[model samples]
Target: MKKHGVISFGEAFIDYISKDRSNTKFTQLLGGATVNVIAGTRRLGIPSYYLCRLGVDESSLFVEKELAREKVKTEYCVRTPSKKICRVYVYLNEQGERTFHSYINPTPDEWLLESELQRDLFENAKIFYFGSGTLFHETARGTTDRALKYAKESGLLRAFDTNIRLKRWESDEQCRETILSILQEVDLVKMAEEELLFVTETSSLEAGLEKLSGLKIPFLLVTRGSKGTYAIRSGSGIFVPAVKVNAIDTTGAGDAFMAAILFGFHEKGIPENLSQLEKYTQFANEIAALSTTEIGALTALTNLQEKVQIFKWF
Candidate 1:
């Protein structure tokens, strides 16, 4: 079989988002950095697969159903009674920025083990994507490492999104250390401006880029919300301004951006030049901006197919 689509491995949980700044009502939505990427890619008409262990809880059931509804293949997902899907209370401010207020995690250690990963999934995927959400735990980290090794051996393009949630990690230092360790292994990396600063322990984006330059990441993206995204290749960078929109919830914008880039890579190939990289980043910024026009991350992606058609790159 020909290698196709994207395979993502990480946490998939429920985001209980506040309806307003008043915090009176909440809405349940399917979310998680990696989940959003997989669903986002599938929404953009790419074949997508999710690899993780899910519990038999209500939230886990919701995640499974939502993934199925999105046409994301979940045949590789493991189901066990010991796993408990994490629930995050997302509080949005007046500006529609979200903060992970609290977590309801009954089984943090329960994760798909390294041995559970099926190598054929990596072999058949065009790109393998993941995030930092599950790396805080030892078992998941091991599994992620194993999956990365499989992806590399299979010659699949590997992508990492440093969707850092400080509250989930034991400490900022640990988060920075864990992420930096994995940088050299991935072909592409996407991070927010603040995450770039945090991971590099630098005060400015230039300094952070300088630090990451040492790792020689093939493609680097720094997303500055409302401002634009910076796409860096071979020490050179270009800023792609975001498409203006009436933002509702800024959540999953980065994932949407990642999905677009990965979608481009899946359809085309790794951008071989700066101009090609800019085109991909420009399209990604449009997708990211559009995702915030609705409340939920996945909810905003319903019209992504149209965007893909408009931004068709052949």
Candidate 2:
């Protein structure tokens, strides 16, 4: 049995989503790559922990309650005085696509300091997951780098998500620079088609793959939404199509996919079986496609039926 758990660090906040642009009524849901991944992992029966600091504010309190409800371990989560949780308003179009609008400035989640991290948490994990959100600000970058370095020293597999948010960064160049920096520390790298293009500054998939060839990550996945997920390992690329599902909202689908892949790793370590990788990839794609059948991120897989559906893919 795998004796280790997974630790993920990044943004944790509330997402206020609405279908109408009028913004009169909104449904609030916990939104963050970190939270979504852990939530999805736990639903898939993987031992997962979340590591992020929150304030004593109402939003933070809500997150606390939700984490408890989801049974996500929070031993490394920080709650400090006078801090506020980050919140974003997401608008969903008719096609289930999303657009983010930040109502508030100074997103507290971006100010995570190096002093706030718990290095001891790295000792008990098999994987450490971090993302582009952690690299946006100076303080959070310092903290993310420290935690990643500690995870590296402790021999934990590092998972990197290049899920790009254009609004978070000042320029495309800065985004590329930070992503390249994080790439050096990651063993497993995940991105969508657009992310691959922007990060590699390439117009085509082959060109993007060529750019990433030097990074030599053990597993590199590029998700192409409806088309499917593409995986590259040992210089070989495999394309797996997504499971057909009626999607209502596209939020958190990528996180769900990534979490399922991590669940595979935690269950049996990295794929030694070429066929096993395909199985896991298809399973993840199913989970992701099913995730869009609901309005909120966590709600898609929060119920027992949804959880059961996750295993049915395989």
Candidate 3:
């Protein structure tokens, strides 16, 4: 068998999205930043794998079934009775920007342990991707650390997305420290402009990049919604403008952008120069813009596959 594709590990949950600002009616859909990345990659014809500990609840079942339907391999996912699938309430404002209202978490401490990670999966994958969702807890943090170690040892490319949800962490300082701890280990990292500022403890984007320049990260992406994404490779930066779209919901746009970047890596390997990086960022921006034309994260991705030839665009 050939060693290929991406392996993602993190939280899997259900998102209850409000119909409007009224907050009266909501539609339940599969969500979680890491889940969106894995599913999005699969939708774009990348062989993807999801690794997480799932409970026996109906929500967990929904996540598993949906991942299966999306053709994402889940053989590495663990099943237990104690784990509870998390639920997040999302409210969309008039501008299609989403605000996470609240979270319903029954087992915040129950997470996949480091010992339970299957090493073979890392050995068989070309890229290993993750986000900040699961790093606040001890068990999940350990698992993430171990997984990264395995990925490095196996010579697999490591990618990190600063999908920061401040509500999940104890404090802003803790979130910054925890996320920065692993920056030196990853080959690629993606962050929104605000996230860049928050993590770097700087007020401006230029200051954030200057702070981040001290680190050895090979590739850094700073996404600035409509203005575009700034791709930083070996300290130099290039701003790639986003494709204009009437975004209906911007919930999973970042994950879509990430999935596109990972797909490019899986198919074409890491960008050799700044020009290649810019092309990849442009393709990612197109996908991200298209994703916002629908409601939910995964929902938007599914609609994108039907409306556009996703694989051909790359």
Best by lDDT: 1
Query: Which regions in candidate 3 have their CA more than 4 angstroms from the true location?
Result: 19-25, 91-99, 303-314
RMSD of 2: 2.8
Best by TM-score: 1
* Candidate 2 local lDDT, residue 63: 90
User: What's the CA RMSD for each of the models?
Assistant: 2.1, 2.8, 2.5
Candidate 1: lDDT over CA atoms?
0.88
Task: Sort every candidate by TM-score, greatest first.
Answer: 1, 3, 2
Kindly list the per-residue Cα lDDT of model 1 for residues 150-185, writing each as its tens digit: 999999999999988888888988998999999988
**Positional deviation of residue 84's Cα in model 1 after best superposition, in angstroms:** 1.1
- Tens digit per residue, CA lDDT, model 2, 190-273: 899999999899999999999988988778889999999888876688899988888887878999999888887777678775
lDDT of 3 at 97: 66
Compared with the true structure, all predictions reach lDDT values of 0.88, 0.81, 0.88
Q: Write the per-residue lDDT of candidate 3 for residues 1-314, one digit (tens) a residue.
A: 67788999998888888888888899888888899999999888878999999998788888889888889999898899998998889887878667878889888888888889988888889999999987888888888999999999998999999989898799999999988887888999999999999999899999999998989699999999999999988988899999999988787899999999998778777888998899888889988998888766756665555423644464
The positional error of residue 267 in candidate 2, measured at the CA in angstroms, is 0.6
